[model samples]
Target: MMSEALRIAETFPGYSREDWAAMVEKALKGQPISRLTTKTVDGTEISPIFERAVGKAPLAMRPQDTTWAVCQRMDHPDAAKANDQVLNDLMNGVNMISIAFAGSAAARGFGLAAEKDVLAKALNEVLMDLIAFRLEAGAAGDAAAKAFSDVVADKGADAASVKVSFGLDPIGCFASTGALPADWAATLVSTIKDLKAKGFKGPFITVDARPYHDAGATDAQELGAVLATIVAYWRALEDAGFEASEALGMIDVVLCVEADQFASLAKMRAMRHLWALLLESAGVDFLPLTIHAESSWAMMTRLDPYVNILRETTACFAAGVGGADSVCIVPHTIALGLPTSHDRRISRNLQTMLLEESNLYRVTDPAAGSGYVESLTEETGSIAWALFQQVEKAGGAVEALKKGLLVDAIAKSNEVRGKLVATRRAALTGASAFPNIDEKDVEVEAVAPIALAVPAAGESCTPLKAMRVSEPYEALRAAAKAAGNPPIFFANMGRIADFTARATWTKNFFEAGGIRSLSDKGYNEAAEAVADFKASGASIAAIVGPDGLYEEKGADFAKALKEAGAKMVYIAGRPKDIMEALSAAGVDSFAFESCDVLAELIKIHDVLGIAPVAKAEA
Candidate 1:
């Protein structure tokens, strides 16, 4: 049967039986497989060999000890309430705060308020005292930088404890801005030096590869861009008078985490190994890289917003298990408009719940044992390392960037991926798979855009684009809650040859409703079997082998079953004459392999309100 199935599948061209067999073989080998069959990042043949030995090394970090934070970007229009939300989040277990400041306007609600003194004062009052503040790339703008300096200057070198990131890449900024300032490199070098001098250890000079990933670049392209960029940073810092080790020490790396669990997991592990090698090659001991991941903004969709919860959960879990030091979940409604306080809370809680409940962080290097994961990790590391070497040969990362080689590589990868997405080969659930036209009806707080306007003392201003209420996942949770726990049951049968297959099918049907299935051995008395089913609350029953028993006691047994008040009796392969004779016995149906038997059984169940006990047909 299996061979025939394979042959038909190979010839059908509709579905590959080889694919199915590969998956089945994998399942047989012990690793659980999802029903969906999608290609891995490397575009290699599918195999199911998972490693069970990779977790030997204690992971440097664990999510169980530290939960990912639920941070809202406080670029809101109002600085103070953005501050208020920060305090609220901290009080509710949100431990990290990240701010994105492009200018005075961007920093206003972040407490910059266009006045360096006031901004510093507000930041110290809100974030310094309440939560860990993560400074985004633009947060290092002259005004914002000075504001940060003032806040930490008083604290001196101990200011290292204050978390901050400078998304400093003159090239990245130039790419976004469409032109590089003549002194951009000078400014980045100076920023790193100044921040280091002020005792900011691990002050991030981002190798922001998210843009490539978001743009649909393959894993290799994304890693390549980052390697190239890191080389640029290394050279930039060394030229600015920092020793190689000091320069390497002055910066930390950040990578994006995606929903593809194994790919994301392998990518992170491979990255760590690569960073260690890179630092070794540069003759510097590698430092602990700090990766703060946000749910990919690019993957969110405007359609079928509810499915975003599933996406975010998967992404957040990936980020945490990928060993991210911190993670921020984007609200499901992000693509719709400005996020509300509730949206932020939900996003935060998503991380909170997963860490606390799922226990994903208890074990370190969770992907270590899987054959697929290890192989993929090695493959990614090799590809990325070769690319890094190539970049060094091409006058380094900056030159590669300037020549658009990295961009072109990403473009080619994106083109391949775009084709996959278009063909539904890469499923984006809400956007491409099952679209929802009805707007989600959750009551969520509306968030305005970040407002940097300074309000008069004691006055308040809302963030830009802030308004309304929306709760995208609330409805889903409510529905799930309402459904409650399903019931459980057991199936009992009387005969094997006569009713084995039918009993198995019936058991599966009932089990779908959470019922269990058990069959009576041949020695069990009919009455005893019925009694067992009754005791187990198995309201449904099947009587089997009446035809074979008829020469001896079939008639008497049917009469006894009727007298015993068996509600539904199924007679297996009863002769026509015997069935007629037994018609008055109230048998519900006579079962046989007519190919249509399964369908007929379904119809009977539907009409009789018989909820099957199992989810699958035996």
Candidate 2:
């Protein structure tokens, strides 16, 4: 087969970058190819095309065709209920479990309290030796780890037979909550000592990127933060009297996987590659780093939450193909409340199908040598390393955060990102974009939270808060829904061909905010549009048509709507030439692509007398 393929390959001529560029420019018709470039928040430009990658080695974590651990998160507050969930998931082919303790970010307000009794019940019938284990305990990490280790011993599970990530991440906890329970170095040393005495060979430290990622840090920022955090722990452990190789083995990583498949895939690959580079630069031997990816909390939507299913699937594929040791799919309904078993089942099945049915694990480092992914990996790593250097210059993750250097970077990125979401530049399907106004309420297991005592403040910086992209849009939708689904009169002014495109877009715009667009098919006369607007009884109105029609009748239509008692008149598609005339004729705003859609929606809501809806915090 190889000889025959090589014989055939010799018959064809190859294309060069110059040839590709000529074609691209011709297709662009005098427009610069730079117009196709997109940028990350860190200002890394991603080109639309690239030549074949050269001299790049594969960075896969596992061997070819090897399946990764299927980790189901155990987070129900009730111990008995959580036990059922764990056993159910395990019985159905899940090979790993991530235990989220109360007060952890992954728990999302509901997790088992780190008590021996609760731990015992949660793992009642499950054999610890049979499955992989992970722990997520924020500032209360020591207590949570101690409690879990003790429970395993009490059940007589041999420590050597079990594979567990202790997941004590003080830097990550402090970065998210702005407080460490104690001196992080002291805490890590004590925790390691206590666990070592119990015969537990450990991946004791975790450098989790979710805190920063959830706080709206871009991929480069999150990767940079993780790199700095891991360096901090490696040094701290060496200082506390561990061998360099042993200290390296004690660390693991967790990164958030969102809907951006190429970025997430590149991020995972870059993480492993970067880790190797970091360790080698410090004169340490390279080890294959263990990475765990969870679907992004920042991308989930409370409204039309099922879209998260699609988002998480794309995320899981990226995580798997990009060489994560394990991937956990956050339930689609998670943003709504505590997920039911059905929700959990759907997530598990989604992952199972990806692995078993879709065969995503059939190839290791699937993105290796691909031009776009390799370019992204290289650029992402280079940008991330520079940021890591910046954090190190500020002393470390803890000190950098304390100085608000990293925090300020996070804030700036978040501001730019928030503007993107508001302007519809970042289209959130089923949330900010094509939203379903009548989506049914999702079900969640109704359970009272296991309230846990928060640790007293150790040191404080400004805490990074988790934010969802759909939040502001959700608030607008909620307000509109509460006001009995307020109507927006569409004073469409043109023939069918002139108005159809803008009218369709205009309808979707208003409906995205839960406002019904009351529009006729087409009305050539201002009198007919005004008559329909007055009969529709909408306080806010929008005029939708082509530029030619807007140039002719736009101002006259705006004047008619205002005279018909429309509180605000909006013109769809900006006709810049007639803007002054429309404004004088009472056109309050212009709605167009890349405009501040959220702000315009809010303004319309104000005219409708709908009170501002307070957003629910994550």
Best by lDDT: 2
lDDT of 2 by residue, 1-618 (tens): 477757866788877877777788889997777789988767778887787788877765887778988999999988999999999999997999999998887688788988889999999999999999999988678888888888889989998778899999888888877876657698789999889888888788988999899899989899999999998998899899989889989999999999999999999999988998998899887777899999999999998888899999999999999888898998998777789999999999998999989999988787888999998888899989999999999998888999998889989998898888988889999877887887787788886554433456677888888788788888888888888889888877767888887888888788788898886668889999888887887888899988888888888888888888888889998888889988999999898999998888887887778897776543
**Which portions of model 2 miss their true places by more than 4 Å?**
1-14, 448-453
Query: Candidate 1 residues 520-597, lDDT tens each?
Result: 444235566556555654344455543455434545555556566555555555477677666666565665533233
- TM-score, candidate number 1: 0.63
In model 1, the Cα lDDT at residue 341 comes to 82
Highest TM-score, which number? 2
How many collisions per candidate?
49, 0
Q: Model 2 residue 486 lDDT?
A: 92
Kindly provide the TM-score of model 2 when superposed on the true structure, using C-alpha atoms.
0.96
Error of 2 at 564 (Å): 1.0
TM-scores of all candidate predictions against the true structure: 0.63, 0.96
